[model samples]
Target chain A: MKSSIEVHNLTTAYGGAPVLWDIDFQLPTGQIIGIIGPNGSGKTTLLKTIMGLLDPASGFVKVFDQPLDKVREKVAYVPQRESVDWDFPASVYDVVMMGRYRKYNLFKRTKDPDREIVLQSIEKVGLSEFKDRQISRLSGGQQQRVFVARALAQGADLYLMDEPFVGVDAATENSILNLLSEMKNEGKTVVIIHHDLQTVSDYFDYLLLLNTRLIARGTPAEVLTKENLTNAYGGQLTLLSKVVNLIKQNEFPIREKDSDV
Target chain B: MNDFWIILTASLVAINSALLGSFLVLRKMSMIGDAISHAVLPGIVVAYYFSEDKASIFLLLGATLTGVLTSLIIDFLSKKAKIQGDASIGITYTLLFAVGMIMISGWMQGNVDIDLDCVLYGDIALVNMDKVIVDGNLYVGPRAFYIEFLGFAIIGFCLWIGFKGFKLLSFNEDYARSLGIATGRWHYFLMGLVSLTTVVSFEVVGAVLVVGFLIIPAATAQLMTDKLKPMLLYACGFGILAVIIGYFTAVYFDVSITGSMVSVSTLIFLAITVLKRRKRQTKALLKSSTDLRG
Candidate 1:
């Protein structure tokens, strides 16, 4: 079977400074893959480069073994929650309907079948009741789900999401993961930029560890080793473990004072 | 009465401005319109210098070119210079407008028919003076009206055809690009349309008050609706309403027509904001009371 995504020597930059360097990865079809890295570790950049949001400085990216533009209709992208203006004059339904725009002619209006798909997508995300609500009025999780519903409405074979779990409640995160599992069961590929390391193994079948470059890529059990974790996190594991311990103790982590007294 | 014509013309101006303004307001680029309106002055001056006539097609072309150039310069400064978008706009128009004023006041020396007063306060009353006679009948009410009408049609058609693209680009530029949409091209196209609209409407409402027409009605509609289509429709409705009321008020009080129209829009915006705030507070209070009883 052909890979769902292929990248060879993929390098991306903003204003001539490299953000993603020498990225080479092949994601097979019908699997849930989690990407984890530190902040500014080119995780989002990799996703954006793959989705064709940012042009690569050099090298190439192919989706379904074809150029991205030619296969745009076969791919769905769930952008970062903060990338969109919440105050924009659009309801949840209107936003979902936008996913169908690529399927129709430039001048053609969205028809009943499009509306039905949008409704079904909303239902899948468990937001059918709030379909008419203003996007700004939604909570962080609902907003994230709205973006997922938009991707679902596109009915693409491949879905790429960036930080879908950020600021989301546990229940909403579970539902999102469950929805991704359902998509995977139906032979759809789901690539997500995830942040939490503890849930990485439980949530994803495959893992792509990155730190401004490719650190490792394999099954979660093979890729989430201590050495790979250290390389991807860069000595922050101790600090992160302490913070996690504080949370387990039902206390917030204390910060060191900047001024030495 | 001639008052009816005045009201009708004002309404038309309002509708045109409001329709285009919705997109501008949503993009949070309202100040760009303000900048283009001011920067077009230099173009007008250059055109008059070359043609020695305000009615020449050269003047319109010059103005449109300068308007588009102003937008491009602002965009370049914001992108290349790393300046904030608002600061770039502010600096660009201020410099261009200063040059325009200097050219008019210092070089022309009040000799040319176009002056500072005309740039600041347009002559809407004189719109009826020039009429088009076709087959021994007055067909076009005024040259200014026809120009504005043509502008309205062009902007309306462009926005209608490009509605999906505009919506996608404005709301999430990255998503639009990922979908293989050329966001930069759409951005420039929208900027071009804005400049065109600013030039066409310059003769009717003057430069200063064009910002009022472009911002206030759409902002008011934003407070009332969360859908793009309704927001645009309501903004147009609100703008026309304000224009009619402002025209009558201007006539009755003998005030500046443009000033009256802007003031009317501002008033409507304030009213809607306050009303929405009150409604939200009431809803919150009711919900709190219900929770307490439960």
Candidate 2:
């Protein structure tokens, strides 16, 4: 099968400093692929690059054998939750209606059929009741669901989401996983920027481990090994665990006067 | 009869500013209102120097060109020069405004048509003097009023046609771009509208009061409603209310009309803020009493 996403030597930078360096990967179509990385690992940058929100320094990205702009209607992107201002005054219905904006002409209003699609997408996410509620009133998981419903309304063949599972409740997580599985069964490609390591093996079929460069790219069993993780994280997990324990037990103090005995 | 035209002209200016201000407030570009209002000074001065006509269409075109230039410079400074957004706005406006001041004093000194005081604090009481004549006797209202009314119609039409694009651009820029909306062009279109509205309205309500109408009414309406359509209606309502109250109050108290109008706008915002807070406190109190009874 042809690859759904093909990145050839993709490098991206912010300001003068490079964040992603000479990364290359080819993701096969119709699978739930998770991009795992440590902090400052360019996972978000990679996603933004693929979505054409951020320009690549010296590389290219192809979705389904075509450039992003040529096939924009066939792709949907879900930005990170923190990247959007939740305090914005928009209803759940209004936001989902934005997904249908692509279907209308430049100056045309959305019709009843578009509204029907939005309603169905909202129902798919189980947020039909909260359709009229302000987006700011939603819980974290519901906010994420609103985003997913928007992507669902697009009815695209490829979906790119950045950190979709972060800070969601257990029920929301399960529902989102089921939705991903459903999409995969429909022969759509879903690439998610994921963080939690424990669920990596269960949630995703393919893993693209990244930390400034391509560390590993293969099946979960092949890429989630101890060596691959160490290569991506660089002993940061052990260091972070020790530091966390020290802070939790009050065993470390930044100031001399703060040390009680 | 004089007061009728005065109120109508001022209300028209208020409506235009408030209409464009709604989007600016939502986009967190309220400062752009202030920047454009101030930056239009040099353009007006340059136009008066070249054309020598205070109410010329060339003047409007010149001011609008400079306004768009101001936006472009701010973008270049913030994006390429790495200057922060607030600093870029401050630097661009103050520098352009100062240059305008120098042109007024150094070269165009004693020019009765345009001056520093008129630019900073407009002469709305004299708005009736500049009338547009069709033939020898046909009067089509004051030129300033017609200009402001034209501005209002253009902005309203644009909003009607491009409401969806503006909403997407304001609410979520990245998502708008992903949907293949031309976010960059929409951004420039909005800035252009802001510039045109400020230049036209500044003749009646000074540069400072233009910023007030652009932000205060829209912000007050925002506090009143959660949806975009109602927010626009409330903003226009608040703006017209300010014009009527401010005009009558200025007549009765013999004070500055522009200052009174801005004061009324600010007071309306403050009133809504206090009312919302009181409602919140009442809800909290009721919730606590219910918990105790339970």
Q: Candidate 2 residues B1-294, lDDT tens each?
A: 678888899998888888889999988999998999999998988888878776678988898888889999999999889898899999999999998888887867766368677778887888989888898999777888988888888888998998888888888898888887878888889888888898898889888779999999999999888888988889999998999999889889999999998899899899999999999999999999999999
- Candidate 2 segments exceeding 4 Å error: A239-261, B108-112, B133-140
Task: State the DockQ of every prediction.
Answer: 0.55, 0.56
TM-scores, each model vs. reference: 0.89, 0.94
Per-candidate iRMS values, in order, are 1.8, 1.6
List residue ranges in candidate 1 displaced over 4 A.
A240-261, B46-62, B102-113, B133-140
Give one digit per residue, the lDDT tens place, for model 1 in A135-232.
Answer: 99999999999999999998999999999999999778988988988999999999999988888999888899999789999999899898998898
Worst window of 10 by summed lDDT in candidate 1 chain A: A252-261
Rate residue A89 of model 1 by lDDT: 87
Q: What would the per-residue lDDT of candidate 1 be over residues B1-294, giving only the tens digit for each residue? A: 456656666676777778778888888888888888889888887888888755566777788788888988998998888787789999999999999999988977666667777776777766677665678984646677767777788888999998988888778877777666777888878877777767777777888888788889988998888889999899988998888888878889998888998898899889989999999999999999999999
Interface RMSD of 1: 1.8
